[model samples]
Target: MTTQQLIDQIKIKKSFLTIGLDVDLEKIPHHLLTLEDPIFEFNKAIIDATHDLAVSYKPNTAFYEAYGIKGWMSLQKTIQYINLNYPEIFTIADAKRGDIGNTSSMYAKAFFEDLNFDSLTVAPYMGKDSVEPFLRFNNKHTIMLALTSNEGAFDFQTLNVSSASGSKELYKQVVETSQTWENSENLMYVVGATKAEYFAEIRKIIPDSFLLVPGVGTQGGSLSEVCKQGMNANVGLLINSSRAIIYASNGTDFAQKARIEALKMQQEMEEIMNLRFNV
Candidate 1:
């Protein structure tokens, strides 16, 4: 999906919530295991229950990769179901992949072409060459990691670096340098909501670029703070709540419980949009 189309969905739904389909077999309802493909069945129930409350659904690739071929097949079915049933909803392959240029291209093709995800998470540690290949895909967003929510982020992302103009943090360098690459407009970013204060500075660098924000709910990130610090004219934020929503309950009513959590976030987002943008 194009950036405009994503923004349009946010407006239509009065929400910019992205539900993370980071399914864990151990945490899912026990009854689902009786199904042939438990992972996909769990995902289908969650998607069916909460699709309207969210604008996007991100399935972290690690969850599928852990189960090997069957896991991958389940993931394929999940994405296919989303594309076929709710084409308007954005899909993200939360595969934080980055490698050499050629390898990166193949990864891009896997997610963008074969799986047909609208976006994919990419690590930027290997620099431009590792990320540019993913950006080259038209209408597909490459969400580069920036200031993350993890405590380890302080180990490097916040390190000061000297530049000709002055001194800036390493995360700032990544954000600024990425804009100079090919098909940079297709670039979005991953800015963890735990670092809500950083969003103000981040916006000064790339005010219009969309940010796929994780670390809400379970991570104790404040929704209101993130919205106040990160929201732009387009409401440029996709706040994700994974464990707190998807694992709300592990019983037969899991899907309904998931919807309740999702609905809470959606209601919060709607209130923020109404107050901030008068939408």
Candidate 2:
């Protein structure tokens, strides 16, 4: 989907919520296991229930990779279902993949061409050569990791580094340097909700770029705080909530319970949008 298309969906739905489909067989309801494709069944139910309440759905690739071939098939079916049924809902493959230039291109083709995800999460530690390959695809987004919410982020991302512009956090440099790449307009970023304070600075660097924010709900990040500092004129944020919504219940009413959880976040996001953009 184009960035304008994504923005349109956000406005139409009055939401920038990205539901994470991080399905785990151990945690899903016992009844689903009896189905031939429990993973896709679970995802289908959740999407059917909460599709209207969310503007995006992200499936962390690790969840699918864990199950090997079956897991991959489930991942394929889930993305296909979303694309066929609700094309407006932006899809993200949270693969966090980056490699040498040639390898990155193949990875991009796998997710962007074969699977047809709207975006893919990419790790930028290998620098521009590793990421620019993903940017070559028209309309497909490469969401680079910036200031993450993980505790270990401080180990590298937040470390101060000497540069031509003087000392700055590594993550800030990552954000600034990425804009110089070819087709940089297609770039989005992963800025963890837990790093809310950094949003103001990050925004100053790239005010127009969309941010895929995770770390709300189960991760203890406040939605209000993140929105307060991160929101731009276009409401440039995709707040992701995973386990909290999808695992709301392990019972038969799991999908309904998931919707209730998503609705709560969507309502909160609507209120923020109304207040911030006067929508």
Candidate 3:
């Protein structure tokens, strides 16, 4: 989907929520396990239940990779179902993949062309050559990792590095340098909600760019604070909530319970949008 299309959905839904489909077999309803493909079945139920309440759905690739071939098939079926049923909803392959230039291109093709994800999460540690390949695909966004939500982010991302403008956080340099690459307009970023205080400074560097924010709800990040600090004219944020929504229950009413959780966030997001942009 184009950036304008994504922005339009955010307005139409009055939400910037991205539901993470990080399905764990252990946590899913016991009844689902009897189905041939429990992971996909679980995802289908969740997607069907909360599709309207969210503008995007992200499936962290590691969840599928863990189950091997059957898991991969489940991942394929889940993405296909979403594309066929709700093509308007933005989809993300939450595969934080980055490699040498050639390898990156193949990875890009796998997710962008084959799976047909609207976006893919990419690690920037490999630098421009590794990321620019993914950015080459038209209308497909490469969401680079920036000030992430994890505790270990301070080990590298926040470390001061000498630059022409004097010392600055490594993440600041990454954001600054990325804009100079080809097709940089297609770039979005991963800015963890836990690091909400850093949003203002990050916004100064790339005010117009979209940010895929995780770490809310189960991770204890504040929705209101992230929106207040990170939002731009386009309401440039995709606040992701995974465990808190999808794992709301492990019974037959799991999908219904998931919607209730999603609805709470959607309503909260709608209120934020109304107050912020009067949409």
Candidate 4:
């Protein structure tokens, strides 16, 4: 989907909430285990329950990759279901993939060409060559990892770096330098919601670009803090919640429970967007 289309969807739904589909077989209810594809079954129910309230769905590849071919098959079915049933909803492959030139091309194809995801998360540590390949695709987005929510991110992303150009923090340099690779029209970014305070500085660098922010619900990142600092004229944020919404209930009412959790977030987002957009 184009950026405008995404904005339209968010407006239509009154939400920028992106539900993360990180399905874990072990944790899902025992009743669902009877289904041939329990993962997709659970996803279908969750999507069915929450589709009206959410504008995006992000599938983290690790959960599927762990089970080998079967898990992959579940992913394909789930993605297909989303495209067929809810084409308007933006889909993101949260693969965090970054590799050399040729390899990155194949990675791009695997998500954008083959699976038809609207966006894919990429690590920029390998530099432009690793990211430029993904940018070549038309209408598809390459979401670079800027400030992450992981505990280990402070190990490197927070370090002060004195480059050939000048002195800057590692994450800031990554955000500023990566903008030169491609146009913001096709590039979004992964800025963890936990880094809400830094959004003001990050937005100054790339004001118009959308940010795929994680760590909202489960990670204790305040939504109001992010909206206050991160929102632009267009409300440029996709705050994701995986465990908090998806695993809200383990019983048969799990899907309904998920919807309840998602609706709560959407309601808060709607209030924020209405006031932000009106003024």
The estimated TM-scores of all candidates read 0.98, 0.99, 0.99, 0.98
Which ten contiguous residues of candidate 2 have the minimum total lDDT?
A: 270-279
What pairs collide in candidate 4? none
What's model 4's overall lDDT? 0.92
Model with the higher lDDT, candidate 1 or 3: 3
lDDT of 2 by residue, 1-279 (tens): 999999999999999999999999999999999999999999999999999999999999999999999999999999999999999999999999999999999999999999999999999899999999999999999999998889999999999999997899999999999999999999999999987899999999999999999999888899999999999988999999999999999999999999999999999999998988765
lDDT of 3 at 11: 92
The per-residue C-alpha lDDT of model 1 at residue 21 equals 90
Q: Whole-model lDDT, candidate 3?
A: 0.95
Candidate 2 runs further than 4 Å off: none
Question: Of the pair 1 and 2, which is ahead by lDDT?
Answer: 2
lDDT of each: 0.94, 0.96, 0.95, 0.92
Kindly indicate the candidate among 3 and 4 with the higher TM-score.
Answer: 3
User: In model 4, which regions exceed 4 Å deviation?
Assistant: none
